[model samples]
Target chain A: MTAHPDQTKAGAGRIVISVDAMGGDHGAATVVAGIAHSAKKNPDIGFILHGRRDELERLVAKRRHLADCTEIRDAPDVVSMDDKPSHVMRHGKGTSMWSALESVRNGEATVCVSCGNTGALMMMSVLRLRRLPGIYRPAIAVMWPSRNPQGFNVLLDGGADIRADAKDLMQYALMGTSYARNGFGVARPRIGLLNVGTEEHKGRAELREAHDLIAANAQTSDFEFVGFVEGRDLPGDTCDVIVTDGFTGNVALKTGEGTATMIAERLRDAFAYSPLSRLASVLAYTSLQRLKKRIDPRRVNGGVFLGLNGTVVKSHGAADPTGVSAAVKLAFQLAQSGFSQKLAARVASAALPPQDASSDDDGGTS
Target chain B: MTAHPDQTKAGAGRIVISVDAMGGDHGAATVVAGIAHSAKKNPDIGFILHGRRDELERLVAKRRHLADCTEIRDAPDVVSMDDKPSHVMRHGKGTSMWSALESVRNGEATVCVSCGNTGALMMMSVLRLRRLPGIYRPAIAVMWPSRNPQGFNVLLDGGADIRADAKDLMQYALMGTSYARNGFGVARPRIGLLNVGTEEHKGRAELREAHDLIAANAQTSDFEFVGFVEGRDLPGDTCDVIVTDGFTGNVALKTGEGTATMIAERLRDAFAYSPLSRLASVLAYTSLQRLKKRIDPRRVNGGVFLGLNGTVVKSHGAADPTGVSAAVKLAFQLAQSGFSQKLAARVASAALPPQDASSDDDGGTS
Candidate 1:
């Protein structure tokens, strides 16, 4: 995003972010605090907070600068984290999540930010904003902290749908590349297909065909196809975007997060093991804080929906104010760069090969 | 295993482990050193070391106890890590990996432990030892360090074969439970079917059917069924066995390992960031070392082949002496407990559901 963070003046030029304020674990107050944090950091951002008017207005009024740049939309209902997507789709009329996405659908907001039930939010997103042309499944791309110079890599299909075939995988490659380009300003992104091994003969049959298909499209797509990458490469510097089906991608994403959290916990325990260690921890506190900042999940908190007509950032349902603020910053950046439109344009320009409307032809591996 | 550590006598009642000394990253010396380490700790373990005669003799002779408990089996060939499984199956009759499995096939050794190529070892294992009757796919179940009472969880298939259906996953559950019972002494182990979500409505179609099938057979199989666990649960104390297809399992395994390695690296960098941290590192050495000992990959470094007539342990290709010793220790435990016969008996007695011979019926998710 070329938008500078210093532009504190709020008015018509501000990029509007539609937020579903009712669904997060900490309630609307936390969401309002997150909005306030973003408003304090970046001057050229505005928000349409969707929730109960009295509560949201009271929260927003506490932050005068936030009040100057924010409008509260009255959404009487709330989408609980446990609500089924089917249930939500059937009777999700005045819910805050729906109201937030509707703002994007009606062109009243550049993007929508929600910390609701992921499945329900995604379902409502497809129903309201719609999938792009020639796209079998829309994917949710999350920024994974990596060893890359950009400090993060784009991993797609973070659980938009459980299954993806050869054609769907190929579409993911295109969308992921476009995401890296627009979101991080990477000139020419490198793409890798996630598999069991880097060998061509390995993995299931669909992955092999996807490998060939992705490699074949590399030249025209204007991205370097790094053939195949194992799960280890997800956090490594081998590629800018790692693509896979939602089942595998979601599992890997959570596995990585869980491992990181476990290690951090262990490190904390190690520091607290003895009096000497505790003293050492106090002495090394600054460095530990620095390390914590580098690997903090809250620092990179949004999973942006790709292949949809409009962009939506799915913040973690349990996110605190800092996490929410980071997600808002991401939404602001994507809106500033017009990520959704460019992604749509990229997919339209480079249509994937039609091998399997259903990937039933690959009988051997899957 | 109930094997006593103090029974270091090399004569009668000794359990012989077949070792492939030709194929690890380090030479036969390291393999011999690992054997010596095991011998130093446990006296009732014997070895049939497969490699070149002269080198094995020289390395074995350096440690008198290891030399006394070991017999050299001269196999003229070596299986490089890059050798294809199919190629090794056809032309690898006299290779050390081939020779190592034959010992188990002929009942000369209680179990086989190899630091050779995993795919080749698995191929040779199936051809030589054969799969247990009624078992469709032989899986490689790995021990993942976790917060379980046993300090680890069993995850399979660790890339034995990429695709697994509802039936395959059911078999994995059976095999994994048996493994936990024998390998970790976890009686009536809890089995979790890996999925995108814990909700029954989530994940691939095969997983849902597998969930039902595994749930139904839990009581008969004598194990607790924890339905639908996500990737994060692998490290948690929720279950003792995590069952999934080879592709997902393999990816999760490597992804977890990679995350650990990256964090460890960052911690090192963090400690080295400044003079104060360096001094703090010195002060916290013992606590840090204790933490390292708890999470070291080498401490739990074996992928046990399940559902085979004979047990086989595939050590990592780049494993060091500590890693090799860990694999040897696991092999010893399995061998002492007659894990192979018990697993075969368990599978033959409690059969899987009859959904799909090839899982072709599930059209929705793969």
Candidate 2:
């Protein structure tokens, strides 16, 4: 679906993003501050801030530029982190999250951004915006800070659905490649199927089948299929888009983040261990700060929900103004570029013919 | 089976480890150097070195201690890295890898350690030593360098079977907990079921079933069940043993190692960026070295094959002398403690009762 018909006449007009300014761990103030930060940086960005009208007006009034470009919607309810997705789908009406997504669904906004419960956000987005045609599942693609030249790798489904079959994995490849191109500007993204080992015969039978399917479609899909890649390859420079089922991708993402955090903490403690080390820390302060910034999780804080009719960016619930702003920036970029429409077209074109039992051998060559 | 029945009277005597000095990427020299390194540190360790006699004798002759402690077996053929397990099982006779495991099968050594083809070694071990009773699928358990007090966590099955059912995961729990207790001396080891989310409602159905199975038998199995732990917990201080199906565990293990290595290289490059950073490098050299040693992959360099009738340690194919030595140390520790027999008893004790059609609901309380 395209944006408002009136806005289409202006080639470089403002893009409005619906924001759910409630349910974040840091409260509504942090979310508003994030929007203010984005508004100051991007002149063409506009927002439909959904939350309590009085609070939204007060926060926006504090930032003149944000107030000029913002519209307030009065939504009384908030989605708690513990709310069940099913419960949210069934009874979560009039909530800020719901109203924000409804803006995207009704052509009022180009993209929807939320710093709320991920499960509830995903559930509400799918229920309100719906899935794309021929797309069985909607995957959440995350940007993993990586050794690639682009400094990141796209990994999905990052906890959207716990399972993916050969067909689903092929669909993920199409969606992830589309995201990598639109989201990261990688002209020819390298798509890799995440397996236990890079070898052809190492993983499950389904993976082998998926490999063939992905390899068979790589040319038409306009992506390079790097065949199979191992877990260690995720943060390495081997592939641009590391495709896996949601279960494995989610686990790998959190594990990598946890390990990086632990090591950073240990390095900090090591620098403070002795007088000489402390002196070294002072000398290495600039370089260490640079390295820290390069690897910081806050720099890339959103997980984009793909394979859906509307684009949804789920920011970390505990995100500060900087982190939330980073997410809003991504949502704004995607919305401006019409990423949802492009992704839908890619998925539709890449959709394989219905398979019987015998055509499985077609995905053999990469 | 007791080792060298004739030496039974000695009681607290030396332990012999079967060594397959072939199929490693570093060649036979690295394996020999690894043995020599282990022999220098340990007085009560002996080896049954399996390889070509001429090459073995020449290498052992250079190290007096290794020559004194090693019993060389003349095995001309070598198991190639490309050899399939089924092929090896049928026609891999007279190979160094086969002879090495035969030592353990014949009770000549307490444990078998190999730097050979993983698939071939797994097949040969199961064929030669057989599976422990009540163990349907054998698993490869790796020691993951972690932030735990023990400095590592035991994760399995690390590519044993790409597919593990509920019963297999439960077995992995028993086997992993047993390994953590005996290998790391983590008394009353905390066992966690690896899942996408920590919540009871997340992940595949089998994980839920395994969670119930593990939790229900924790007291009897003598492990502290930590409910569901996410991938982040793999390197965090949450659990001692993280249990998952072979596929997930393998991917997670490699992913952690890969991410750690990439970061280490990036950190090193950051320190060497400029003259000021170079000077900072010298200042932080000692502390950085300590941090490097704390997270070095070489320190914990072996994947122990669990749930089998005999103990087998698979060293990294590209390991250097130091890496190989770490694996030897692990093999020596397991041999000294008679870990294989203890594991057998644990498996037998934790064996599930015969399931009726309706009583399969036992694994649901957690």
Candidate 3:
């Protein structure tokens, strides 16, 4: 095999990330711009851009650096943000989202990044790539901006599917821990089961049983169990990964995002309230920018779907180029570390023999 | 009955609120100071202070307004924050929390306010006052600061009990609507069932059934059902009352509080980053204060326990005088509106025939 001079210098393998340049609220131009941003920052990254060939070509033509590192796959159709997952499974034959996942499934790319409908993306990914062996359900794990030494926490089952039994939660803990290790390079991630209270006797029956299961398996799983944690701990430094049913995790994720947005609006309104305050804002502009940088949602943009046979990162549908780049960057990192293979091996080694398997009826609905 | 000059001028009846003065983190001094603050603002308010007489007397000594409006009732025991609700129930006869609830039960006070252990307070309230007719479960409703014209939204069951079924969620909707209408004067309050997504087909089976029940009863129940709402809507104007099971409500509440605290600390740090920024802070101090006051949890301190025979407001255990005063003020307003009776009437009128009453296994556990 002939090795490129660039690859030899870094001595790291080249990573080809599949990009679905369609269905984002901002459209394909923004996604192409994001590819440009990633290519400018990391020379080792390559992309197989999935969208209408002519349009992608025009957009990539503007960025010569990105064009050199990009491969355009002619997917004639686009998945609308409002497209139903089931409908997409039947009709999304030549859509960018479909082609994007196909690349990962066919070994052309190690990771797929899409700023598309999350439900549709998950559905197509599952149909094409399948669930990892012994994995009951796949969960969308996202990085929560936190006060931890690593500056983030991993929260999963972020609305991949709403229902989880005691066993599914255990899987989430293992999957989340694996993601934290491969994606963030955290050694022996601390896992916390999200509950209403930190006490043992609190929350539902399933949560209690799941707590015991996680604690019992933590050592063998190569992670530390921090027991039950409340929603407040999502952004705290006490744990690296918070595992919960998708219903709660999704609500908490949206709640946190909404809250951050609300505060940002309020702060802006405060600064713009009076002429004197506006003048003060000018003086403190740099400090305010630093604060914004610290809490920027765009910096932690990707929601990586774990417990699946292949890696797929779901960028926010409304993401700008910066947000898309953040998602692409995460995909690159995970792809480089061979996250999919490591995750499969972890699940195969640590997962219990599907005890109480019948309890997962509620999980398969959606 | 002869009316006092203070009561006759307002043409409104005087309200006597029972206070559990012993269990708060700041003790009787803070409770007395809160009463003083409330009494100074509203002439028609009175209090029945429950605690050690000598301790209460010393704290009330400096507050002339509180002294005139207060009636002391000696209760020797106190319910510590860590005390289990069941333990408190078995041996809490002389505790201030017990006495406070008893005052409401015996018709000596219109409302009860306690800054004690929440689980203990909930247990005592259920034990002494009992659930209202046709109500299967009682819930704790809190005021979340929002962008609504009312400036706040109502959220419940904020840790009253963790488990809720379909019928219980329907009852929460009716009860929360009643609270919003009577307590906040929101005419025909819009109710939203809290879920992972606003889609009709999302969430657990219970939530979906509850959505249908709420929608079906909206016209007859005298409130608008806004369908399912996400956690972001808790702080948004789209809904007035967000109804959910206690587990989700409690987690969302704490998560919002934690996020707000994190942002506030970051904002402070930003302002203190440099000398020039410190000077800018001085200039923007007033605007910042306004912003702070707008989102101050203390300003909306009380968590009103609904669907009970009597009104019970649980203040934060660590509440300072300002926070305590806010809870007291809420209790007084609720008392004046005859909110307890109104809620009981609403529950009695709107509740279904308790079709799935057997599902409430943990309803009375606390």
Candidate 4:
């Protein structure tokens, strides 16, 4: 691998990441720009960029540094944000999202990144790479900005599939812990079961059943089971990982994001309210920026699919170049640590056999 | 009702609000102070204060005007915050919470307020007041500060029960709509079922069934069915009422609250970072206060238990004088509008007959 003048060192190891260049809200150009940003910062990263060949070529050629490190695979079709997961499964061939995941499945790339349809990506991912052996479900784990020493917490099943049983939650606990350990380098991370209250008797019946299952495996799973945690604990310093079904996790994630956005906007409107406030904002610019950086969603952009045979990082669909690059950075780090294999091994070693298997039916559907 | 010199007018009919003064975290003095604040603001409001008579008298005596308008009902026992609902139900006859509810259950008080154990209060409420006819599951609806013209949205069941089926969701729709129309005067309010996504096929099977159930009843129910709404829409102007099972609603509510708290703390840290920013803080004080007031949870501080025979407003256990007064105001407005009776009528006339009654359980538990 040739190092650009901007690069400092490359002795670690070359890591190639598959990129879906066309599926993002922004076109291939913005994705290429993100690749350029990543390339400029690191000397050991390569990309298997998937999109329309001519368009990707034009975009990559503009960023002269990215051209040598990037490979363009011609998958002309784009999987739109509105595409259904089932519909995409049947007609999703030759799309950028499909091509990118294929690279990871076919051993052309260790990790893949896409700012595309989350549901469709999950569908295609399960189809291409399949689940890790003995895994009951595959979940997407995202890094949440928190007051923890690591500055983030891992929250899983961020809408991968809406349903999870007591057994599924136990797997999330294991998978989320694995993600925290490998993705964030948290040694023996603390795991929490998300509930309305932290009490043993609170929440739905399955949550109570899952709580016992997760706690029973804490010693063997090699992580601290913090028991039940409420929604407020998501950003608190108490726990390193929060595990819940996809529906609740997804709602909590969006609720947190929406609240943050509303607060930020309210703050902006406050600073812009009067001439005096405007002057204050100018004087407090760097401090405000410091706070923004502390809570910024872009700083933690990727939702990595865990329990799959290969790793795939789903960036926000409307992500800018900076957001895309943040996701790429996460992808590179996970690939470097061989997160997928370690996560699979963790699940296989610690997971309990599925109980009854009939499931508490009213649990997810009620 | 006797008009204190501090009060301005007494032309409107008298409103008697039953208050469980002893159960709040700060004790009866804070409850008295909150009552005093409310009493000072209006002349037509009366309170049936439940607690140890001696203790209540001492606090009410401090606010001389409150002594004239408040009636003390000695219940001696207090329901501690940690007491389980089942335990409370078995041995709660003499508690202040029970006495307060009794006042509302009887014809003495138009509405009730309490800051006790939520589960205990919920259990006692269903036991004492009973469910309104035709209503299967009782819910707690709280007003959320939002981008709507009304400046708020109604969300339920704020943890009244952890489980709600499709029919319960439909009842919540009508009940939430009734709450909106009576409490906030949002005519022909838009009702939305909270889900992971707004897509027709997204979320759990129960949610889809709920979507159809809710949508089918909207025209007859006199509210616009906005279909499925994501967590972001909880605070958006896209809807005035968001309906979901107890678990999701509670989690989303707390998640939003936690996010707001996190952001506010970060903003404070930002302003206190440096000497220049400290000066900027002084200059921006009023605007900052304005922004703070806009998002403050205390400003919208009551969770109203709906679909019950009588209205019960649960104030935050830690609420100060302002928070208590806000809740008192809601109870008063609800009483004035005959909200409970109107809600009963709405549910009886518009609610779909309980379908199957056997639920899809996997949802909330999952």
Give TM per candidate: 0.90, 0.90, 0.89, 0.90
Model 3 misses residue A7 by how many Å?
14
| Tens digit of per-residue lDDT, candidate 4, span A1-366 | 211122212212468888998878887778888879999998779888999998888888888778777778899899987788888999999899999999888777888899998899988998888777656678989888888999888898888989899988988888888888876789999999999887787888899999998988898779999999988888888799999998999999887887787778888999999999999999999999999988977778889998778889999887889889999999888887777778877766764655523332222221
lDDT by residue (B279-346, candidate 3, tens digit) is: 89999999999999888778888899987778899998878999999999998888777777777677
Candidate 4 chain B has its poorest 10 consecutive residues by lDDT at: B2-11
Candidate lDDT (C-alpha), each: 0.84, 0.83, 0.84, 0.84
In model 2, the clashing pairs are A212-A363
Q: Compared with the true structure, what per-residue lDDT tens digits does model 3 show for residues A79-185?
A: 98777788898999989999999878877778899999888888888778877766777899999888888988999988888889987898898898888887678
* Candidate 3 C-alpha error for residue B357, in Å: 13
Ranking by DockQ: 4, 2, 1, 3
The DockQ-based CAPRI class assigned to model 2 is medium
Top-scoring candidate (DockQ): 4
Model 1 TM-score (2 dp): 0.90
Per-residue lDDT tens digits for candidate 2, residues A234-345, read 8888899989998998888887877787788888988998888898788878888888887877778889999777899999887899889999899988877778888877
The parts of candidate 4 lying over 4 Å away from their true place are A1-14, A26-30, A348-366, B1-14, B25-30, B348-366
DockQ for every model comes to: 0.66, 0.66, 0.60, 0.68
Clashing pairs in 1: A8-A43, B8-B43
For candidate 1, lDDT tens digit of each residue in B30-105? 8888888998999878888999998888888888878778888899999987778878978999899888888777
